[model samples]
Structure formats: C-alpha cells, structure tokens
Target chain A: MTFTINAEISQFQGKLYKLSHESTSTKTPMDVNVFVPPSSNSKIPVLVYLSGLTCTPNNATEKSFLQYFATKYGFAVVFPDTSPRGAKIEGEDDSWDFGTGAGFYVDATTDPWSKNYNMYSYVHDELPKALAKEFLQLDFENISITGHSMGGFGALSGFLKNPGKYRSVSAFAPISNPSTCQWGEKNFTNYLGNNKEDWYKYDPTHLIADYKHENQPKILIHQGSKDGFYYKDHQLQPEIFVKAAEESGYKGGVDLRVAEGYDHSYFFISSFIEDHAKHHAKYLGLIE
Target chain B: MTFTINAEISQFQGKLYKLSHESTSTKTPMDVNVFVPPSSNSKIPVLVYLSGLTCTPNNATEKSFLQYFATKYGFAVVFPDTSPRGAKIEGEDDSWDFGTGAGFYVDATTDPWSKNYNMYSYVHDELPKALAKEFLQLDFENISITGHSMGGFGALSGFLKNPGKYRSVSAFAPISNPSTCQWGEKNFTNYLGNNKEDWYKYDPTHLIADYKHENQPKILIHQGSKDGFYYKDHQLQPEIFVKAAEESGYKGGVDLRVAEGYDHSYFFISSFIEDHAKHHAKYLGLIE
Candidate 1:
C-alpha cells in the first residue's frame, strides 16, 4: 500500500500531508490527511479521527482546529475520508445518508455493499498497517482514536472491538447504540443483511457490556445538549450506553459530558477540541 | 439598511451571527458575519476583517480561527463579504480573479461597475453605521482593521485614507503597491478608471507616504517567505511598501515580519492569528 503525498501544507508548527493510497479492504483508492508536528526527531503518537456523514478528509482537516493541538502535543492526527469515492454501485449515490459518504464503519455482509463497504476492516486493520509501513515517523502502536457522529460510533466500536489496539478512545456526539438508531438500522440492514446479531457486535453499548479492560479503561465522550439529533429526534441515545456501561464489566468507565448550547456542527467540536486533545495527550503520555 | 440574521452559531465564548443586509452604498444585499464576545455588559470594540478576492463571509468565519482570539480578547470581529452578489453585469463572474469576488474595496467610477462596485464606502461607512444602529453592543468607534491579500490592501488603504478611524491596522500577504501590481492595476483601471491619481488615492504606499499618524501608528504585517505571489510572481511586493513607509511620513511605523516556509493560504493566517489578535487587543485596549 504505497501512499502518494497529494499536498504538504504548512500549518502551525507542522505540515498537513494529504495522502491517497489503494486500499485492500475496500479495493478502492482512499484519501487521508495526516498532520505531523514540527521539530520531531523520533516517531510520535498518532490520533486517528474518523469523520461523520457527508464529509471528505478535508472537512475535519479544515474545520476541526486540531492542527494547533497536534503541534502542541507533538502528536500526528490522521483524518480518513468518511467513505469510498467513485464507486458506481447501483444505489451508491441515491441518498446522502445511505450509500455515499455513509460507510457506517462496517464490513458489509450483503451482496452489493459487501463488495465495497468494508470501512470497519479498512479503517481499523488496513489503514494503520499502511500508514505505519509508509510513514516511518508515526508510532501507530501508541495511538488514540476519536470521531464525530457516525464516525464517533466508529471510534467507540473500533476501540471496543479491538481492545489493546488503541491506548485511549473518545468521541463527540457519537451514536451510542447503533443497533437501535434509525441511521444504524438502515445502514446495518443494508450492510449486514438485516442481522441484529451482527449489528450488536458493532454497537458500543453491546460491545462494552461484554468486554472488560485490565486497568479499568476509561472512555471520554462529549454530547451537545442542543444537538438536533440528540434532542429533537433522540436518535443518539448516549444515556443508554452510559447505563449499559454502569451495569456491565465496564462499569464507571464511561465519562459522558453534555455541553450546553452546542449544536451538531464543527463549531461545537472546535470549542471542546482542547479538552479532547489534552485527554488523549495524557493517555498518549505527551502530558502528565 | 435593514439587516436579517441568517444564522446564529455559538462558538467558544461568543455568538457568530451570519447576517445579510441591504447596502445603500452598493445598492445590493451584502452578507456579513459578526462574532460577538460573551458577557459584555457594555459595547465592545470591533475588529473589522476584509477578505481577499474569491471569498465570501463564510471563508474567514469558518477557517481563520479568529473566534477563539475574539473570545480571548473580548472583542467583536466582523467579517464582511468581498463583493456584491448576483448583479448580472456583462462580464461579472467571468473570471475568478476579476469580477464577482474582486471588488478591490473600491467605489467604481466607471459606467457599468459604478452601479454596484462600492465596497469601499460599504465597508468603511455603511456597514459600520448599520451595525451600530442595529446591534448597540458593538463599539464601532473604537475599532481595528486587518485583512489578507487584496483585502489586506483594503485594510491599509482604508486606514490610511481615513485617519483616526481605526485604532490599529495589520495585514497578511497584502498587495501593498496595488498601483504597480497586475491585480491592483487591473482592478484600479476598471473600478476607478485609468487615472493614476485615483489609483494613488487607494494605494497603501502612496497613502502612507503623505498621511501622518498621530500616535506613532504601528502597522503590523506578516508576509510568507515561500508565498508564491511574493516570491515566484513577485506580484505582492510587500518590500516596496516597507521601503515607502521607511522614507515617508510613516517611517518606523510599519512592522513587516516575514514568516519562513509559509504560503498565502488560510493556513498561514490561522498559524499567526493569535499574534494578530493580541496586536489588535493591545490597540483596542482589551489587553495591556
């Protein structure tokens, strides 16, 4: 998986490298942006950020205000595209939420989607391996994972499913119980062949209920109080995951903070990015 | 001069208000975004930002990273659109560099353009007056001005032409000697006719040559060393303006800092936004 440097932009005391590489899992060319902090002599810790729906690598790279924090903590941040591009499947570009830009971080079991919608294995398995082999300056072993919305679900599920793979995990307005949410129900049914059992494997609440951490693993989450998805539709049932965690082996490990007056936008993510960066920095050992 | 609130977003400790208003100067509806700091009992000082060509109010509002600084300094930042929209001129929107987004902050004196290209008066006079009347909390009287590229030229010319209007002025990769540059020459010829005297009135170098600042006026500027415009094309000759200031009435007033390995993109602006914010904060009396 040889990566091509699309652009190397000077941002803060670092360089934002936009890279594209052919993926084995999705069997398509994937675009990812990595921000490498300046004045680094050795391999640095990495933070993989999965973006939400309808986003390319450029959305979070431009709006998340993560470069400042990445430079401050000497950590590299990788922003992967939400889904595969130019895949001319029958219903790929049908809707904004269903196919294109909505990979849902799942290895699809169904026919049409199974061919290309392997984002879970792509992001968790193929991407890190490719990045580690390509960029020698990034320490993929000491990495933290985070995301927003559907990508938030990706981070939580990825961290939970592959324990000990990521040192720390956090999310911004993640869909906690994807098995029950409308967005999850639609994508899972299409991607996983309407199998509830397969959907539960990817749900954060169900995964956390069975999985246990050796050192009482802590997961950080921030949900906006005024988020339209949280309040108006009640699709993101964060409290359900909190309740499930409290009753399971991962009891008292979830730290869910509801920020006041923030909506589901990058404006909300940027305001609280400092805290999230510090949280990851502490676990990544960049800060005491 | 009636204003309509397009959107109000909470960012950091301020509210970013996207507004559209009918402009008397341009005789068109203009879009502007204002970030007002939180918990201000009295009117707060304003920092007006003029964007470069090919930018609307949304560019800086989303990418400039100025809201954090606005909240930190307790000052309101105003981002005004670069040019009038949907005017339907013969050659408007023909080229990205010339027509629709390239008002050049000048009130056109020619036949076709004179009908709507009145950005100078719109930004300097009409916008502030309307904002003051509508939002009584913004102290337009005590304001600072800054911009990037062509907008940088706008800030310098606007400040120099109207003495005592702005408390401080700064620019990033500004087209300083607009009369001598291709971009400046083209816009000046179209907006103000081919009169060299009219072009001189809007040129920062010529304006600063004669105008005497009362309080040892310090104009801060940051030009990227690797900026393609500055190095390759030699279009943004910032040094000429520096030399002009050194020999003119504004001697010792211009502080032009050349940043190493930076480009003329928002990445450069976001990198040094904190310093620019602090500079404006000092002159706005928000910080010592």
Candidate 2:
C-alpha cells in the first residue's frame, strides 16, 4: 500500500511532510518524515539522518539541526525510524537496548526482530525510493549519511562497509570502538550473535584501523569535552579512532572538533551543525 | 514563592535556561524559556520574541530561525508563553481565540481573566526582571521586540506604546489593523470589553496614528503575498499600517518587505529571520 503524506508548514519556516510506507524487506510498515529546503525547486540534495537508541523517526525530525543547513544549502533531509514498529512479534517488547528502538541500522537475521527489523535496507533503499517517487526535488545521487551515538555507529559502519553508498559520512560522539564499549558490546553481541568479526565490521574504529574506501570522503567528528558518557576519562575513547585514522592512512582524515563546556545534547549537535553542513555541501558540490 | 530554573543545553547549538516565575502581579506562577547566544559574556543585546495564538514559550524556542541570528549578532532571546495556564477559572476554557492560549499580550481588565491574564505586565516588566536577575549578560537597555500574527501585534503595540523602549521592532505577517480582524475582534472584545476606545490603546495602527515617536526605531515588516489570513484582498492588510506610518509623519520610517511565494508559517520567518536579526544587530551595536 502507498503512504499518504500530510503536508504542513511549521513556524520554523520549513515544509513538514509526513509519510508512511510498507517495507518490502522488513515486512512491516514504517513512518518517515522529510524536511525539504525552503526552495521551490524540487531537485535538491538530501541528507539521510539516523537517530540513536531509545529514539524514533520523530526525534531527529523534531530536534536535529539539519533543517537550517537544508534551508541554507537547498538540501532535503529524510529521517527513518530506528526500527520497525507496531508489530506484536516476539522480543519486540524487550529492553530498550536490543529491541524495537535498536535496529542497529542493520538487517537482522534472527527470529522475532528478523521479521521486521531491517532498518539498514529500509533507510538505504525503501525510503529513498519512496521519497523520490513523492518529492520531485530530492537528489538521491548526492545524499550523505549522518547520526548520533548508535546512529553514528550505524552511519560509520554502513558507509565503510559499503564504500560507494554515501557521498560523505560524519557523526557526533558515536560509539567509535563499538565492539569495545558496553552499549555496543551488548547490542553487537545480540544483533550479530557472538561473532567478533561481525562486531568489528560495524565498529567505526575497527573500520578505520582496517582502512577501506579508495575514494574517501571528508569525515567530521564533533565531541563535547564535558560529554559524561564518552569524555576523555570515560570508556568511550574517540582518540583511539583518531589514532586509527592516523595510522591506517584513512582518506579524508578525521577533523575531530572538541567543543568545550558542551555535552551530548542537541545543543552540541546544533553548535557544530553548520560546519558539518558545509563539509557535506562542499563534497556534494551543493555550495562553493 | 519563587520559581525554579534549570539550565539545559539544546541540540540547536545554544544554552537553554528554563524559567518558572511566580507572577506576583497575577499571583499565578508562569513558565518561560530563553535561548542565549553562543557568547561567553552576558552583556549582549536582547530580543524579546512574542509567539502567536495557540503557542507556548516552547514554540519559538524550538522552531524559530533564531540560532543563526543569535549566533551571528550575539543576541539573547526571551520567549514568554502566550498566556497563563493551569487554573480552571471562569471563561478560561473559552474558544481558542480568547482565554488560556490567547493572552493578546494585554492585561485583562474584566472578570475571571483579570486575576491571571496579566501578560502585558508579565512581558514588559516581570519577565525581563526575572531574566535580568538570572542571566547577567542581557542588556535590557538595548532590547527589541518581534512576533508573528497576534504576537506581531504585541510587538508593534508594545513598542509604540512604550516609545524609546526598544531600539528596533519587526514582525512576520502581523495583524496591522487588528481593530478590524476577526482574531482581534474576538480577543479585544473579551479582554478589553466592547469599548472601541479601550481597544485602540492596544491597536498598533491606532497607537501610531495617535502619538509618534521622535526617534522611532527601525520597523521592519515582512508579509507574505500568499498569506492565508492577510492577503492584499483581506481585512488583515499590511498596507494600512504602512500608509499610517508614512502619512503620520513618524521619524523612523517603516521597512515593509513583501516576500513572494511565502505564507504566515515559520518557513517565511526562518527565511528572513537572519535579515531581521542583522537589522537589530546594526542598531544595537552588536555586530559591525
């Protein structure tokens, strides 16, 4: 069945389009929201934004700083739900870590979740195909992928694992060495089973250490100095990935920005969003 | 009783201070949200944003195209809720145009509302006083006011009545001749009684026609050509106010800009907000 999109304008000075679609791969319907640039022209570049754990499509659509950039660069933004929802299947009601809100942006192979939790294919394929059919101005060819925390891990793993899929990639305080972090350790162990190699494939730091992507895109990483979860003192060390980028000869070497007196909040994301937009805009050739 | 405030950071890249104030004037506590510029010093000029009908402090704080301007011009923004909430007093549950959500930015003189509907005093004096005590850097001496629809009316009426108060003023599709619009008629009749004389005191066009300020601050007006409420054919015309400003011999002339293909939504506000902030910044000496 086709999704009906509700069109409305926000006081934020942007167009809000809400649509729902049945995923062929996931076997479950998903809700998605897209914010197009203020421009009347429809063929604008797009940014695929993934959200973190305990978040749905509504989180980033309602809170992220991508719109201002989209409004400025005349780009469109597509936000997909973290996992398939509304089904009464088994294990869907489990803890917040490995269940509904945590699709891990990968195609699940196990039961219960495997029935509908194919977020990787949903975000990369189904939604884009639906968006292009509905909106005339969306440029799928110049799309970039980005997210925060778990979503950041998804973006890094998804982009590195499939090098030519996205124009560029970046994240804010993502689980860099996810295989080593507790949150990542728990999720990876469940989602991919006890396969350590499968875990490294989704780990950004591990990908950096191994080195992939002959045509590397600019990577912008923004981390708050005061972020309680992954500060320099915390278990989630971003520098290890920075070091990995240095040693592995990664293309478009990391531009790690340390924001002072900031934390792991949208305020931190919004503060440096313009820089990320500019980075993507430059690589996508949307702006000079 | 004192209101409690907690400082939280927004993903929009700014510091958010949530304020709850005991409105001594009304005996009912009020909740307001403020977003400050990315400046270390608090001595920045302030812009008091008044939202339209059916809105709260959260609307502008969450949506407005303010961050770009706030960051660029280094101005703090104070967003007060449209009206007082919680008490189930008489007429409080009236239509959407009056009572609870629609404070009209005026002090209700009649029954039921008079006790808690003192938005005029709250915005003009108490809110600023609270912000001043809490945020040290806000320069009240160099403050400006702006809004949308009813809030726009509030800005114009507030600035016009309190001449020499704001260095500048502007609005997005304001109800210029509110004395005749349906929204104004409904709000003013209930809040100000059936007396046209009382309504004139809150009407911008009427206020400007009665008394002119010598150093009239730069008044920037942006009205969409396709505004659903105030098109060229409608009663909510911007021309009447523009003509009144021109013929009334006001010192500071109005800068009326008609945006093509825009409406009364935030998309219109976001598109031109930076320009408005720049206008205020130039007069307040925040940016060269």
Indicate which candidate wins on TM-score: 1
First chain TM-score for all predictions = 0.97, 0.91
CAPRI classification of candidate 1: medium
Which parts of model 2 have CA positions greater than 4 angstroms off?
A1-3, A8-17, A35-44, A54-59, A90-101, A129-138, A194-196, A231-237, B1-3, B8-14, B38-43, B91-95, B225-227, B231-237
Q: How much is A243 displaced in model 2, in angstroms?
A: 3.9
| lDDT tens digits, residue span B217-281, model 1 | 68899999989999998778889998898888674478899999899999899998898999999
Note the Cα lDDT for every prediction shown.
Answer: 0.90, 0.78
- Candidate 1's error at A154, in angstroms? 0.6
* Candidate 1 lDDT over residue span A219-287, tens digit each: 889998989999988778999999998888584378899998888999999888888899999899999
The predictions' CA RMSDs to the true structure, in order, are: 1.4, 3.5
Clashing pairs in 1: none
Candidate 1 structure, TM-score to reference: 0.98
Error of 2 at B244 (Å): 3.7
